[model samples]
Target: MILSTASSSQANAAFWRFLATRLLVSLLTLLAVSFMIYGLIELMPGDYAERELFRKYSGTGVTITQAEIDRVRADLGLDRPFLVRYGEWLWNVVTRLDFGPAFRVETSVNALIGDKFFYTFVLVVGAMLISYIVAIPVGIWVASRKSGIGDGVVTLLSYLGLALPNFAIALVLLMLNAFVFDLDVTGLVSQEFRDAPWSMAKFLDFLGHAYIPLLVLGWSTTAFQLQTMRGLMKDEMGKLYVTAAQARGFSGWPMLIKYPARHAVMPIVSTIGFDFSRSFNELPIVASILVLGELGQELLLAFLDADQNTAAGILVCITSVIIAANFLSDLLVAALDPRVRMRGGR
Candidate 1:
């Protein structure tokens, strides 16, 4: 009883220590990203309101005088020192999750991002789910088959997937639908449900419309996972322990699963951190091609429009998400592989 209690206590202490280390690292990473984003925003050519007003008045025979620009800048607090503005924005984020309003639209940053964020999150998660579901079994089968015809075909398909970018996939599908199928697979939902509130019909419409985008986003990831899993499993199978297991008369699926597959899964586990960090950044072109209005689209518009607060809010949100994912991934890897936990402790 005493040994069990001590062991549990020690494990709990180690887990908390590991968590603390990850939290500190995540916080520092977020701060560094925020600083870089703020500095870049400061270095941009003009404030959001100025450029927008120029667009609004430039061809209308109304001169946007320097006086008008200055007044607008003053009113928007754009003339404040960079550090001061950054501090205020940071405080607002910390205190109230308020990243400020869109300079032209006059909507809160969160309000502008809320629905789009959900869409992007769903897109990324759906892609990842599809990638893993297809990749793992196919990868294992190909690795086990090695030089068989099925393996060859799957290998060719994976290579093709890697060669084709998501945008190319989107373009090809779009053209095929346009020229051959007479199908309209361009957007997330039909025109009727575009602005309609959520309903059973809307949800079903979304499912119907979501498959193409999901395929565009997920295909490459699935291919990459397949290649990675195949290589790792192949390597693991060739190791001395696998040879020993074979010598012990465990020759087929049992040997593969009991000996090699468990070891091969670690790299895939570790990649979750990078994958989570990257999901939001990938497939922007795909999103644009499909008119999905995902977060990547919103971020691009925010940057082009010089909506610094909106852009900053997005950066913070993305960074926070990545950090949280990293933290979780670390714990997951540690749980799956004791080596990682030991290394972390050291």
Candidate 2:
């Protein structure tokens, strides 16, 4: 009993250390991503002040003089050294949850992003859940019945999903809704509920409109995950351990679930963060096509308008989410696979 207790304590210590290390790595990654995003924005062709002035006076036939642009830059503190501005922005973000201001909109970045991030978060997370929930069972089934008609059908669908761009999917769905269903499927909320205060009716209306984008986003993700799970299961099923288990009178669902299925799930869990990040990377174009007022759409507009602060703020938020997802994936993998914990500890 004493030896068992010591062993348990050592395992606990190792697990905690693993978690701490994973967290430190995630923080460092987030910092590097943020700095790179800010640096890239700084390196862009024109400053926000120049773009804003041109946008404000372009069609009105008013010349935006260099002096006027310089004065506006000074007012917005764009005249400060890049490092100094980044330091202040980073400090505010870390200390007070401030993301600075949106240069073009003349509003706090936090306020501008208020509900957009929430909507995008829901869509991305929902898509991920849909992918995994569908992938795991179907993958196992297809792997067990390889080369069958059902498997062939699924393979065809998965290929099509992977082959088609997300925007193409969105456009096809839009056309289908327009020609056949005649349904209102664009945006996160119906026209009436778009500006309405949050209530049960408004919430339900939002969900009604959200499903189109959700399905559009989830389509390719599900296909990719399904293929991954199918491949892994097939590989695990052919492994020596599985064959050994079969020789020991194990077969059918009981044997498959206990051995190969359990093992196959580890890689799936480990790649959840990558899947999530990929989905977010594809989101901007998809969201724009769907007319969804998510952070993805805002991000594209920010870049086009030379609104660096808004773009930086949105990129930082997305990067942070990706890092957090990766951290969670590590915890989950460690929990499910003792080998991972042992390796990390060592």
Candidate 3:
């Protein structure tokens, strides 16, 4: 009983330590991202409003008074020093979860999210799901058949797919859909229900158009994952333990399917998380190429116009999401590897 209680106490202590570590890491991530984002926003040539207000006629542009610009800057908290502005923004975000309004768009940050969050979410999730579905089986076959015709074919395809850019691939797919299939995916809808209300049917209709974008985003990364999975599996299959198992007549699909695949999942999971994070940030380029209704669309416009608020909002959100992805990856790694606690994972 005493030993058991001691063990329980140790477990509890470790749990708290783990939680504290995660909390500290999360706080550090937030600070780093905040500082980096603020710095980058500061570095961008000229202020958003300043550029816009001056673009038309320069000194004689809007005839805007210095007092008005100062007032506007103060109201936007732009006049404050970087540190002070950060503190103020941090306080608002922590207390209110408010990210202010977009400079380029006719909506609040929250309102923009409301208008487009579902579409982005669907696009990301669908891409991830399809990628995983395609990667795993192909990875297994390539690994099991390492250096055989199956592996050769998969390798060729993976390389070819990786060589193509996501935007180009998406553009081609879109053109084919429009020209070949006579699919009117040109404007985020079919003509049949372009005027329909926001409902499940309409949402699905939007998703139908979204599929091309998802595939474009997913295909290259999926090939990368498959190659990694194949390599990891191939390495594991050549291990002494696996060789011994095979010698013992335990050689079959079971060994490949069960043991090697299980071991291969570690790298695959980590890679998948990394890929997913990248896909979110990259959607902007794809959005521009495909004319998809997503935050990426806003991001492109933000950059073109040098709209600080809009660009910063998208950057902050994207950075936060990617940080969360990394956090989840750490948790997963810790969960998977007992050595993490004993040796301290990086």
Candidate 4:
């Protein structure tokens, strides 16, 4: 045993030690990510204030002089030193949970992202669940059947799914809905429920419109997971331990799952980390095609409009989620695999 005792005391201590290390590392990573995002936005040419001024006055009635633009820039804190601005932003976030006000929209970054975060969460989470549900059995079936027609069909579909971009999938679904189904598949909510207050009707309406995006996002993820699971299962089944078990009359699903499948599934668990990040990163293109006004779409617009505060906050939020997902996956792997636990996450 890695611990001094074979008792609960040793197990509990090891778990706590692992958790504490994960938390500390997560915090440090978050800080580094925030700094990088802020610094990169600062490096972008021109200030938001200048952009706003040009937008307000360019080709419009008023003429913005250089002096006036400079004054506006100062007012918007663009005149502040890079280090000073970054320090203030970081301090505000740590102390007050403030992400500052977004230019053009004139709302706090929190409010802008808060309004849309749930929908993004819903889309991503729903897709992830669907992917796992479809992938697991399909992967196992393909692995077990190996060289059979069912395996061939799954391989073909997986390859196709991986080849197609998400937006292409969304576009195809939209075309299908238009020509055949007549289902409401365009946006995140129906027109009536869009501006309406929260109600059961609105909630149901949201689900009704969510199906297509969910399918598009889930399909690619399912394909990737299926490929991964199939490969891992095949490799584990070929190992000496599995061959030894088979020689002892262990066979069929029980033996497969009891021994090899457990090890095979580790990669899938670790993949949960990248899967979340992939879903978030893929959202912008998919959301744009579907006209879903979630955090992904909003963040894309923020970048286009040079809305630095909103953009920064959204980036930070997404990065934090990715980091948290990875941390959770680490914990799950340690818990599931005794080898990993013994190694203390290496």
Candidate 5:
């Protein structure tokens, strides 16, 4: 009894330590990424002041003078040294949660991003859920039917999904919608609910339009995961433990689920963060094509306008989501597999 209690206590302590270490690493990574994003934006050719001034005077035959540019820079505090500005920005972000202002729109970065990131998060996460839901069963089924026609067909479809670009799929769907369905396929909401208050109708309208982007984003992810799960399941099935389980008369679903499936799923659970990051990497172009009012679109516009504050804010938020997802994945993996916790403890 005493030994059992001691082992349990050790496990609890190890879990807490693992959590703390992951938190520390995530924070440090987020800080470094934020600094790099800010520095890259700073290195861009023109500042917001320059872009605004040039846009204002261009095609009017009025040349923008150095004096005018300098005046605008001074007013916007853009003349400060890079390190000094970055330090202040970092401090403000850390202490006050102030992401500063959107240079072009003259609005707080926080205010400008209101609800936009939420929409993006909902779309990305929804796609991820769909991918996992579809991939797992199909992957298991294909792996079970290895070398059969069903496996060949699924393998072909998975390859096609991975090879075809997401934008191409979106374009094909758009063409089909235009020519055949005549349904509204763009944006997160229909015209009636675009500005409507949050109600069941508006939310249903959102889901109605959301499925296109979800399908587009989830297509490749589902294929990749299906291939991964199938490979992992096949590998696990050939292992000694699976053979031993079969000898014990554990067959079919029970045998697969009890012996191989549990082990095969560990890698998948551990890779949730990477999957989220991959989905986000494809979001900007997809969002633009679909005319979705999400932070991905805002991020592109901010960079084009040289609005560093807005761009940095959006990038940092996206990075935070990825980091948070990674942290959660680590926790889940550690919980499901005691080996992971033991390694962390060591």
Candidate 6:
């Protein structure tokens, strides 16, 4: 027993080392994305100050002196060579936790993150909760039925979800809420209410607006999970070992609990981290339809109308969020799967 425990502890330690290595790679990828953002910003047809000049110095006497533009560039650190600027930005970002500041928005980049992150978290987490709650039972039902009528129904449902876009789903739900349910979801809180605070009223109001996101995201994945699990179960059930278990009078529950489900769970858990991360990307479409004051809508605005600085800050925040999600996913998968430890793959 001691020998087995020591071996398991050694294996776990090695697994964490592999995970650390994988995280280094992911961090490098994020750094590359940041560099790309910097390059593109530098490559913009005009200086970063050009847009601000137009907005601030609008109509008459807009003939800005070249020296002034150069001064602005120097202030923004844009006068530096692209590589130099990128290195400084990367170093400052990673070490000092300074992503600089947004040129357009008055708020600090980190402040902006704090403002919108909770909403994004609330939306995505709600959706994920609903997906699992619905998907798990549906997957089991389809697997138990195995190529029968229930499975056919689950397959069709999955296809329908896979076919529909989030925007389409959100829009349909919005129209229904407005026209049919008359829910007044536009106000995330009540019309009389204004802020999100810890209160029963706020909690209930949040829940009211949460359903559309929950339903759209949850329903989108149910089908895919159902199909994946069903196929996995089918494959496992067909194994010679499983046949022997059945012949030895092992019951259905034992076969499912001990055999197929355990084997099938690795793939599903592997995807959960990805799915959770993907929810952030999908936030904009839902935000657009519902007119929610969330990060998705904010990000779209940052890219579309806000200046380069604002967009860059948003991009930085987004990149950080994505990297964190991916890292968490890797850790979750490592923890969930023993084979992952043996293979030295995060």
List, residue by residue over 33-130, the lDDT tens digit for candidate 1: 77787788778898777887888888789978888988888888888998998889888887998988877578889888887777777787788879
lDDT of 5 by residue, 231-303 (tens): 9999998899989988988999988877788888888888999999998998878888888889977888898
Cα RMSD (angstroms) for every candidate in the order listed: 2.5, 2.2, 3.6, 2.6, 2.2, 3.3
- The candidate 5 region of ten consecutive residues with least summed lDDT is 337-346
Q: What is the per-residue lDDT of model 6 for residues 1-346, given as tens digits with 9 covering 90 to 100?
A: 9998988888888887888887888778776777666667566577656666666787876688788878877876667777786677667777887766665575566666564666677777777767767776566556766477777777888888889988898888888888997766763556554544557887787787777777777777666776777778777777888788788888667677676777776677667657776777777777777777677666655554434445555666666666666666666677666777766664
Which consecutive 10 residues in model 1 have the weakest lDDT in total? 337-346
Please estimate how well model 1 matches the true structure, expressed as its whole-model Cα lDDT. Answer: 0.81
Tell me the lDDT of candidate 6. Answer: 0.70
Write the residue-wise lDDT of candidate 2 on 107-175 in tens digits.
999989978998888999999999889988899889988598999999999999899999999999999
Which is the winner by lDDT between candidate 2 and candidate 6? Answer: 2
lDDT of each: 0.81, 0.86, 0.72, 0.83, 0.87, 0.70
C-alpha lDDT of candidate 3 relative to the true structure? 0.72
Task: Order the numbered candidates by lDDT, best leading.
Answer: 5, 2, 4, 1, 3, 6
Error of 4 at 27 (Å): 1.6
| lDDT, residue 140, candidate 4 | 77
| Model 3 lDDT tens row, 183-286 | 75654556676556688887777777877887788888888888888888888888888888788888667877767777787777666557767789777788
Q: What TM-score does prediction 4 earn?
A: 0.90
Per-residue lDDT over 192-263 for candidate 4, one digit per residue giving the tens place of the 0 to 100 score: 777778889889889888888899999999999999999998888789999999999999999978888888
